[model samples]
Structures are given as structure tokens and as C-alpha cells.
Target: MRAAKRRTSREVRTGNRFAVLRAMYALGTPTRQELAGATGLSFATIATMVTELLAVGVVTEASREDSGGGRPRSRLKVAAGRGLLVGVDATETYVHVDVFDLAMTRLVHHDHAVGEGTSDPDRMVGEIAEGVRSALAAAPDGDVLGVGVSLPGQVEPDSGVSLFAPGWGWKDVAAQALLEERLDLPVHVDNPLKATTVAELWFGHGRRVAHLVTVNLGTGIGAGIALDGQLVRGATNNAGEWGHTTLVMDGRPCRCGRDGCLEAYIGVPGLMAQFGERHPGHRYLEGGSQTHFLAAVREGLEADEPEAHELVELFGEQLGVGLANLINMVNPNLVVLTSWAARDLGRWLLPVAEARMRREAINGSAAVVDIVTSAVPTNPVSTGMAAFVLEGFLERVGLPSPTSAPLRRLAEA
Candidate 1:
């Protein structure tokens, strides 16, 4: 049997530092004592971590907290201007990049379009690199810590390889290495489900729930699951491919060459197919832009068009059925619909989906789960990728000293 790897002192220290930093980031400015309470670390350890953060200019001292007794504790916050982090969201239609500061404030957003079948590994890598460059160009003065990218389909977490991206026709692609080489920066890659889920966990409805599932609804469909406040990555890091599950026998053809898959009925393409069937000669259909088609559908719905209402009602019921299965399997307290498709159609879809979900779900599970639309104001996948880059930055901020050389150089600059 393979031996397990033990945690080194540096790793332990890094984890401790991240814990402290994450607590402060989430709780706003907090005293060392409060950080200790939140992270369950000793007060001395929190103090040491805070000192290291301060030395690196990654954190700054804020107003003192009233202790309600002696010795007012000084609050510390993550410094918003220390450095920048880049997040790349590579979807089927576009490669979107956003630059953010240490405090998670978005500084710039850049998007590059990808033509149909622009799935060559080299081309995708180049497009993503260009998008990141465009975003970084907007903030030339800040120190960019690292880049986190969200690629569609299955990704090998440890090696950062695109194991199998069906839409891109990529298998065993060295995505991380290629991106790092192209951009000359550290790159971390994962799928959209994981990225969007992390964003929801940090900034959306999942923040208040221990058991949460974030459903990614876009050109593709999947789920990102969290149980007991921990992200669930199954064996081989492919836990959330819920889109390929069989929803009906001999129903619709799926991209995975499967019949009756959930995605075939509810994904963006599936919805477009339904709309095309309803209105065989719509102008938006001729343009072949899913975005334009969805917009037109929304317009039609607002105008009380019978076809649009019928399509949405059917779509909602199908979506609810899918959610019911997911809820039954995960038994999560909350399921948040996220990504572009949900953001665009949520207001019209949520009520019908929820009602159908309750009817289809097991009564006990349905009673506890609350299905809601995403609350994140930004692109969730990109925002989550930024959070990932931030975590990586914090983990290695001061590797060998009170202030790492990199941080010192950035601060001096």
C-alpha cells in the first residue's frame, strides 16, 4: 500500500496562516482573540500569524474593539492593495478574466470570444492567456500573485490537467502547464462546477448552510456539492457530473452520446432546441447565438406569448425534476441555481421549478431544502477562481520569513 504523506511544518504554518486570513476576510476586521475563536487556534499563534501578515503588508490594523473590559484588542483586516489575483473563466462561448485584489475587490474584467469548435487545446490555451493579459493590462501597477482558471468538464485536481473536456474534445491536456508557460505565472485549473460552488460558499446562499449544492446552469449543467462545510470531490475528483444522469428512458440525445440525460432536457442547448421547435423561424434562432435566443425568449415571456410561457413551464418542470433527484441524493439544506443561464432566467424559472421540485422530491428532504437563485453579483465562476488564487497566495505568502521576498519587492515597488 502507498504510504500517506505527512504534513510538514511549513505546510502546517501555511494552513494556520490561511485559517487566520480566511476568518478575517469573512468576518471583516477581527481582533486576534476573535480570530482565535473563529479558527480554533491559540491566541499566541494568531498573534504570530497576524504579525507575519502585517510585516508582508497583506494585513493592516484597524480600529480597536471594545473588550467590554480592560485591554482593547486591535482589529486586523486583509490589506486591499497588497497585490492582485487573476481568475479566468473559460466557458463554451468566451474566456472571461477578472483581476482582483487581496481583499477580493474586482479591479478589471476582460472577455474574449471563442468561435464555435475553437476547441483545439493550443487555441483554447492561447485564448485564455490573451484574456488574462487583457485583464492584467488594466492594472499594470499591482503585483499579480497568481492565476486561477475554471475549465469546463472533468479536471484532474492534483496534476491540474484537463482529463476530459467533452465540449472541447480534449483528453489528458496539460492545461495548467501550458497556461503557466504561456503567461509566465502560476496557474491553477479546475472545472466550472467547483469554481462556482466555491463562489456560492463564500458569497452566496451557501454561506449560511452547512450542506449546500450549487447547480451550474449554462451551456452545460452540473452540481457542486458541499457537506458539513467541506467541498466534496469524489474519487478521481469527478463528483459532480450530475448532468449525464439518466432522466428518461429513450428521451433525448446528449452530447455524451447518451440518451435521456438530464442535460439533454435542461441545458442551454436543450432549451434552445425546445424554443426552435416552438418557433421554427425565429430571427434569434437564425443568428445561432444562445444569448440572443434566450433574450428573445425572455421578451416573448414578458409579452405573454403562449409559446414562450409553455416552453418555460415545461423547462421549469424538467428543471424541478432534476433538482428533486439531486436533493434526494445529496439531502442538502440549500441548492442555489447559478451561472449565466440561471442568472438570466431565474426570475421566471424559480417559482415554477421550486413548486415542481417539492412535488417530485421526497417530502422530508423537500421540507428542509430551499432552492434559490444565485446572489453573487459577479460572475460566480471567475469570482470563485479569484478566491482560489487568494487562498493559494495566503498559503505561501511568507514562506521563509516574517515577510517573503516577493511581498517585500511588491511593497517596495
Candidate 2:
């Protein structure tokens, strides 16, 4: 009976160790005292866990800091080159794959286009798997902790299944399992917007900001909401579908079977369609149309072409109205607009949008929220994807102690 009790006690200790590790990963290096405070575990317990983690090379200690009043205290941080995390962004037109170190730095990145209207789930998975293999070949000799795939659709996180992605024509596919089987590593799958939001919260401008909204205006327009420091994923993990928000009662038909959605007005296809309608002679070279439009907008502003200026102003107005609704509803402290539209339009688009937002938002003071474009101009999505993987790693191993009030609350939940 004594032996049996010893075994049970050891099992409990092991479980507590895992819990503490997770807390540390989330906090990103905490002193022993801090770890204990965050995890709600005793100092003795944390010391034991930290010892074990250090023994296994999962964590390391930094130099001691002089406290001035007492013995110097040593800081602890997760070792940076210990492992790798994979990120995959499977979009309608292309598949972007990247590998990152524990610090969220991209080590390798590759992109390949997928044929339009291609709905073969198996083929898509195969292509992604190949990309992963290529990334692994380039990665340093560290163990891969996991692979995360971001899809532009509703995802059931628990099940790792994509419910529906009209853009990619995917439905009820177990993407996580497929990748896991192929890669033999832990797999996490989530909506692209949510994953991007997570990336921002941890590594981008959203860091340190409690409430923020990220608007990704690419082939499609989508919003990712972070409320009160937590991602607000609704019942179906589809809360931030701001693209389908109707701007006009019956203005224009959207691909999502809606009338006058923001996407119908601002999405890539929508913008091109509008341009085509107005300028019949305008021809787009392969993959050159978006660039040409941006050039036109730039030149038009300088040339004072009434037609081009009017088109851009209208685009900004519609975007501003939609953003105003979001600001009023979420009251976020920051709004990040990303994509070719925001990047290309630059200051030409923001002032007008800011004006409209000031007029329509609940808080007439637009000063409350800082609206900005993405800092990482090239491969923002891929960089964000890499950051997402880093976030998972940090959550599992680098956070503060679990006994602290803030960390305790997060752990308990």
C-alpha cells in the first residue's frame, strides 16, 4: 500500500510539472518566485519542475539580477534553438509554408500556387505535406514540436476539422489528422484569421494591447477579434466574419450569397470587377493587374484624375464605414489593416477612412484606437503564421509561474 501511494504521488507530480511548463511557456521566462506566483504551486514544487525541465534541456537560466536589498535573483528563459514549429497557410490560390525557431523567427519559407476551382482535399494535403518535407530539410537539427495549419474557414479546434471554406471548396475535412499522419508530429489547425490574430497578440502590434481587431483584406476580407486580451472565437469558431457584413441593403451581389457585403466592394475580385466595368480598355497582364491598379491610384492622385480619385475615395469610404461599426462594437484599442489594398492605398486611403470613422463610431474621438498598417510588409501572412507556431511553443513552455494572480486565472480556465 505504501508503494502504491508512492506511485500515485509521482503521477501527480508529473501532471503538475506539465501544468507548470505550460504556464512558463505562456509567460516567456519567469523567476522561480514568479513561476510559483503564476502557477499557484509552492516554491518547492516549481523548483522541482524547473530542475526537471532544465535537466531535459527544455529551459535554461539567465544571469542573476541584483535586487539591491537581498541575494541576487536568477532569471529563467526557454532555450531558443531547442525546437522548430511548422506553419502552413493554404489559401485559394496558393499554399504558403514556413518553419520557425522557438523564438518565432522564420527559417524557411516556400510558396506555390494552386489551380483555381481545385477542390481536391487529398491533393491539397499532399502538396502541403511536400512543403513541410522541404522545410524540414532546410531546418536545423532540432526536433519539430508541432505543425499548425491556418485555413480561411470555420475550424473546430478540438476536432481539428474544417467545417466549410467556400473560397477553397473545403468541407468537414480533418486537416489536422491528415497532417499528423504524414508528419508524425503534433498538429494544430485553426481559422486563418484567428491564427493570424493569435500571432499578432503575441508577436505583432497587438502585443501588450488588451483589445484589438485585425482586418485582413486580401482575396477576401476578414476580421479577427481579440477582446479583453483573449481571442473571441464564438460557438462555431466563426465570430469574425466581418466580410459578409452588409454595407448596402441591396447594392451589389456578393459571392457569399449576400447583397452589398464589404467583400463585394473591397475584395480583390470586386476591385478588379469594378475597374473592368469602368475602364473597358484596361487590360491586366498575368499577375500584373493588382500592381497596375496601385500604380493607377498613385498616378491618379498626383495627376488629379477625377475618376481614379473618386474610385479610391469611395473604396476608402466603404471600408471606413465597416471599420466604424467594428470600433463601436468591440471598442478595441488598435485596428490593424493588412493586405495589398491597405498597403497600396497607403496614406491616400487612411485619412478619409479615419474621418468617416470619427464621424460614425460611438466614441466620436477616433484617438482612442490606433489604426495602422502591418509593419512586416513582405510576407506578412507567412510571418504571422510563423509567429502563431511560436505562440504555441511559448504557451507550452515559456510563460511566468502559474501561481501568480494573472497566470493562475489563465491556467484555471
Candidate 3:
């Protein structure tokens, strides 16, 4: 009989694999010796791990490079196309689903309009499941490694549950487990802002920064923080609750039953409320056809409507005030503005917002931090969800587990 294989400590195996994956991701394409050096692992150990990775088709070897005084060295890179991950974003008005490879390249995307005030969680999840299935069917010879769902609420990733989603009327819903049961794959769940932050950290402006804040202004305003290169999911997985932060006490009421919350002033409804108050006859739908409103604003510029300009300026100032508070608290190296508002109002409103931020932010912090718009412009939520799923796949398949200590040690080494 074959000797029973002894199992190693889960922590050790996880740590070692994570180290190797980190080195691979950082180096892009590295030789065995280079990867060993980068990961602080012995050359022999790295060689064994690389061999296993190649066997599993998670990584591939490239053409050898010849050195002046030694044998040729073989380069290794992630086999991006070997597997795919599915991501779904279920919002109040729309449901978006996308499929991406391990390399985080989008393969297919699908979107559908969801009726407003449809707070039935089961029905919404079913619709999302259908969309994800459709997206997967469109993919070419790709096997799904995992699924990630991004929503507008507090999520507990470990439990695969949405603790609360006021908009969806969901409480403690096992979103990930439900998706996994339907799709027959591992699932990861996160808030839209957190997902967007992950996407930013990997491929957007946050890539080069150690600490960053991503503020998403859309149907609602929310934030995600990456402090010292780690995504800060608080004890309850609701760390960056900037939306609920009171900007004005006893002001406008928010959906979360709070008065004068930041979301009440900067969210889509707030903008439309301001528009309606100013232009009583103008019919604009909140969170619907924002392009129409933006067009109207452009036309107003041509017609020189003072009210339109004033509303835009006011929106900028309010946004700036909230951002200034965040800047003072986090003191991030970078701050990214995401969602439809940022895309539409960024150029016109950024200067105003920046001016306010400069006025309120701590001395020199304003100058040190780079406040910019999100690079992933089209369907950021969908892209972010895809990135989140890909990261989970990476972790599941012994690529890398995202942890602060290991990453810090690797950087130092």
C-alpha cells in the first residue's frame, strides 16, 4: 500500500503559494531564479512549484533567453486564457454580468434593465443568475473558475452574505451561496465600491499608490479604502460607509433613515431634486437616462441657463466638502472619482470640487494627493466585479491570497 501523504499546515501552504503568485503578478514574466529572488523562496522550491503550476496549466513557460556566460533561462507567465470568472452587478435599475479570464481581460458583457422599486431579493438574484448564465454561454471555450457579485450594500465575504441592502430590501441574504448553487462554481460577494476599489488597485490609477480612496457617486455615494496596499474591509465588512456620513445635520433625509447623509446630497436623486427645484417644468428621471440630463446641461451651457450652471457648481461644492473630510481622515496618496456623475460632471465640476477640497483639506495633504477620475470608464461596476472574481480564482487555485503581511515582506525583500 502507498504511504499516506502527510498534510502540511494550511497557513504554510497558503503563504508559500501566495508568495509565488505575488512574485509572478509583480514581475509579469520572470525566470525561475528571478521569481525565487522576488518571493524569498529557495530556487529548488520555486522550481518545484513552477513545475506543478505548468502541469496544472495555470502558468506557461516562454522562449528561453541566453546569457553571456551561462545556459539559457526560461521565462514563466500566467496562462491567462486557461480559465474564466464571472461577475455580476445587480443595481436598482440594471443588472450587468461579465466574463473575464485570469488575466482580468473581459470576454463578454451583458446588461438588462430592471424595473425600479422591485425590492424582491429572490427575483432579482434569479434575474442576475440568468444574465450570468447567458454571459457564460457567450464565452468561447472558457471554464468558469468562480463568480463574484457586486451590490449596493454591506457584504460579508466569508459568509457569502449581504448583511443589508436597503435598496433591495435584502437582509442577511446568502448571495454567494445562491449563485454558487445555481452556477456550480465558487462565488465571492462584495459591495460595488469595494469591487471597484479592487479593480482600481490592480489596473487603474491606484496601481502605483500605496494608500488610496475611491469615491463612487452614482445612484448612491460610497467609498472604498486601500490603506498601505490592502483593501480595508472593516470588522463588519462595512468600513467605508461614506455615504451615511452626515454632511449636514437634520438636512435632507437619506434612504438609510438618516438625515443629511452625504448620499442625500450627492447621489442621483439629490441632483435631480436640485434640478427639479430649480427647473420645475423640466422632467428628468433620477438614475435614468443621465445622458439626457447631461445633454440638457450642455444645451443649457449653449443657452447660458444660470440655474443649470448653478446646480452643477453647487453639486461640486457639496461633493468637495465630503471629499475634504475623507482626505483629512485617510490622507491617501490618490483619490479616484467613479460612476456616471464623475464621468459626466468631472470636467465641469472637478475644478470646483478641487477648490473646496483644497480649502478644507489638511495643510500639504491636498498637494500630496492626486485626485483623478477612474480609468475604467465604461461599466465600472461590471469590470470591478469581474476583477473581484478573478482575484478569488487566483486565491482558490493556489496563485496568491491577498494579505498585508506577505505583501509587505515581499516588497521589503
Tens-digit lDDT string for candidate 3 (331-372): 988889987678776777788888999998988788888788
lDDT of 2 by residue, 312-406 (tens): 77778888899998888788888888766677775688888878888888764366898888654335565555554544554466532211112
Clash pairs, candidate 1, are none
Off by over 4 Å in 3: 1-27, 32-55, 285-305, 394-400, 403-413
For this target, which candidate reaches the highest lDDT against the unseen true structure? 1
TM-score of 1: 0.89
Q: Report the CA-based lDDT of candidate 1 relative to the real structure.
A: 0.81
Residue 188, model 3: lDDT of: 83
lDDT of 1 at 158: 64
What order do candidates take by TM-score, descending? 1, 3, 2
Ranking of models by lDDT: 1, 3, 2
Q: What is the C-alpha lDDT of each candidate?
A: 0.81, 0.72, 0.77
Pairs clashing within candidate 3: none
List, residue by residue over 191-283, the lDDT tens digit for candidate 1.
888888777766676546678899988888999987755567776778889999988999899887889999998888898887788778876
TM-score of 3: 0.86
